[model samples]
Target: MLTAVGVPAVVLLAAGADAQRPVEKPAAAVVAEAPPCCMELVAPAPAAFSAGSAAGGRIEWVASSRASVREARALPAGVAPEQGLQVKTILVARAVSAIFPEIQSIGGVRPDALRWHPDGLAIDVMIPNPGTAEGIALGNQIVAFALKNADRFALQDCIWRGIYFTPGGARAGGYGHYDHVHITTKGGGYPTGGEVYYR
Candidate 1:
């Protein structure tokens, strides 16, 4: 029964009252965007931006929910079971944040991008120093982090221009294998049998 807490005295329909209207799922929030210049992650970021590094470098965007927030919300008190996907997305964001703290700007990417790709665990970032040697090194480190942590969570795909790895946990059908690396986490993370992409 839904209750309107307004001045008008209202009653929620009896426990099994017919729903007044079809429940509408809230639109998924636009979290982040990936840019062409950024690179994948392998491990945690270096403590200090290499002094040798310059401004406007490549970056990875991170959404707020790609972490473990999903498990808790899976059965939210007021939410219906049908919201699993949304809940799962929230989890992915939480997991990503847990696994990758270097990602800081997922929301910078606009909804309308030149090439918009959607990956469950991916958060887009804008790297300004992509053209510099430091940028290249930065990208390599991130890729290494992603490869190590694939098993930590389920990932739809990891798309690095040169080459990419995919977790064998789920989405092994390889639907977009040719287009991108499909990765799914076994909850704990992707640990082995993963491939590496290189330039």
Candidate 2:
């Protein structure tokens, strides 16, 4: 049974409950208008993606589950912690942060010489407790989410846990992607609103 918390807006789902809800126009509007909240509800991306180990010479793609969060709820707006990021980049960063509250720090527009960061096209989602098992799992989920929503976000690539993921496929051995997930997006105009979604 679904139990109501002190706030009507907050409902704690039972363990293992499939919290996925049908996408509604009102929910989309809420996501667009709601102020960024770290405790916003998020649904794990359904379906799986192909992945391969970095050690292999020929990448043998295998199916990997994308769902990670325990339950689903309406997606809320997100905040951009770092500055100097593109408008599209900011929107995506906000979406990611709202989807994953564990991610507290997001780095953007750094002086990486000629890299994507210097061009304000990249954002780093730093993983908390990166050495722990939970951290690894979170990183995996974030990567999966990014890959799943690549076209919607105009994502170029996502690197995490030594693996590089694109809309097409994923390959391991991405250097320096241990503690954080790196996401790069193609150039795009500012979002008019309701561009991000959990489903």
Candidate 3:
């Protein structure tokens, strides 16, 4: 009824065999676990092509193509294709990081999704917490920056801009962007631009 640190060879062999048994998920649950790939990354798009960009620097749909619309790239800041991470995306990320160091290190202001927004520019800036003061401030900054540089960044859609959260409804500088903020510019849907759905 007792097993010592050093067990008989036979007992140890049996125990080891039992340990090797593999565990499997329930058939029904297993199917649900691996969901199909609904979203995918595409090539970078141009600023002039998409419509996700807003008017006068407001955020809007990514493109006329409903499919592409969702895949719009939220611009970060500058444009550099060679770098794995786009320059614009990195710039915007850096901007937010500077304003809020805590969140940035913990992973905030990075796009939940990013690509060619099809509105005008490319890359989507995804704000992780689209509902907090920090999130709001970040969102506001994105909108303001795009607007200020309308001529340069091409200022695509700022969909996460007008989101309005109650005094404490969510907690954001913009509207219901607490969940996640989407900042699209112009670029490929594939490979992504790092933008989260804010509203």
TM-score winner among the candidates?
2
Q: What would the per-residue lDDT of candidate 3 be over residues 1-199, giving only the tens digit for each residue? A: 1123332111101101111111233322211221111112222443342344522233433323222233222223322232444444444444433333333332222233533432223334556566666565555554544443333323344445444322122222544434444444333232354343111
Give each model's whole-structure lDDT: 0.28, 0.56, 0.34
With candidate 1 superimposed using the best TM-score fit, by how many Å does residue 102's alpha carbon deviate from the native? 5.4
Q: What TM-score should be assigned to candidate 1? A: 0.31
Ranking by TM-score: 2, 1, 3
lDDT of 1 at 141: 41
Which digits, one per residue and each the tens of the lDDT, describe model 1 over residues 1-199?
1113212111111211111211222112111111111113322332233322222221122211122111011111111111222222333333333333444423211233432222222333333354555444334443443444443334444433344445432222323322222223333322242211110
Better of 1 and 2 by lDDT: 2
Which residue runs of candidate 2 sit more than 4 Å off their true CA positions?
1-79, 189-199
Model 2 TM-score?
0.56
Angstrom error at residue 150, model 2: 0.8
What's the lDDT for candidate 3? 0.34
- Determine which window of 10 residues in candidate 3 has minimal summed lDDT: 12-21
Sort every candidate by lDDT, greatest first.
2, 3, 1
